[model samples]
Target: MSDPVRLGDVLAGMATPGGGGIPAQPGAGGTTCNRCGARADWHRTIRDKWILIELGEWPVGAVPPGKRWRVAGEGTAVNLGRAQPSDTCRICHFDVCPSQPAPVGSPALLAQWQKNAWG
Candidate 1:
């Protein structure tokens, strides 16, 4: 097996806002793909036994949120159930580390960096 890609490499061009917070879409809370600049879906796995026990079998809902990707141009969403690590671009299908930490900088700088890297 190959080594996992670092998240920092993927978010190289995306800027961190003034508060050093990730820019997410309203309601969706998704960040732009570092490869294609399209919305990338994310999900957090709840593996804590104590939290699961406290919430009971049903937990937060009948089913936990699963990983999904929105297709660029097509505007279609694909649900990828719990599986291996995906560090690829949803639109371009290029390898990218989406789990890595984002870089800190202004939006303009980040955008320029991304364009230079991708373009």
Candidate 2:
């Protein structure tokens, strides 16, 4: 049997850089939020992208239909929760984080992602 899904798994499956689930494109890896057709971006902190999922800012289940909200500009890290971005493939949502950058990839760029990411 496979291991159960952890918060990391959920985030990674979304294909964001950290555990945060932000797709560079909606439906990039067949990723679909029950509420939103597809995630626009991962961090509202970077740009207003995701909807709150609901009032009171609850987790997965508590989100009310239509009321989903997204974060933008610096919000408290605590509010963001411990979640990171998806390591899964940006296409299938079924891969782990890449440890090494591709050939010709800039190490400086990856370093910036590491600084901003949780892991």
Candidate 3:
């Protein structure tokens, strides 16, 4: 019998590094966010849109499990699936964007901004 595909599995399968997804362009990998001017590493998402991945990786527990991300082999930003013990994941710049207010009622996100965010 075959195992049923779950939503997470489906989502993960949709993004394979160096697969059909758009390649990261030269000089676009590093830049500053115009809204708040924070340093970030940009990568093209599978959906064909740009995403601002923070320049560093943090402990898996530092951010919510679902919010964690990792750079794929081809420079694509992808979710940090099924975090194991002591795993580290890169973060999205939007979570710490000083120009935008932190999400209400989520202490983890708020704490992340207050502790290590940059303008």
Best-fitting candidate, scored by TM-score = 3
> What lDDT is reached at residue 85 by model 2?
31
lDDT tens digits, residues 20-119, model 3? 4544443366787777777788787666566788787787776776677887788867866567444678878888777778855457567666654543
> What is the C-alpha lDDT profile of model 1 across 6-94, one tens digit per residue?
78854652322222243333234355555445443432212211000010112112222342232323333343343323443122112
Model 2 Cα lDDT, one tens digit per residue, 1-79: 6988799877665545433544344322223333323322232233324322211223323322222233333431123
Sort order, lDDT high to low: 3, 1, 2
Model 2 clashes, total count: 18
In model 2, the worst 10-residue window by lDDT is 88-97
- Where is model 3 poorest over a 10-residue stretch in terms of lDDT? 17-26
| Candidate 2: residue 31 Cα off by (Å) | 20
Clashing pairs in 1: 7-100, 87-96
Better model by TM-score, 2 or 3?
3
Off by over 4 Å in 3: 1-27, 81-86, 104-112, 115-119
TM-score for each of the candidates: 0.18, 0.17, 0.64
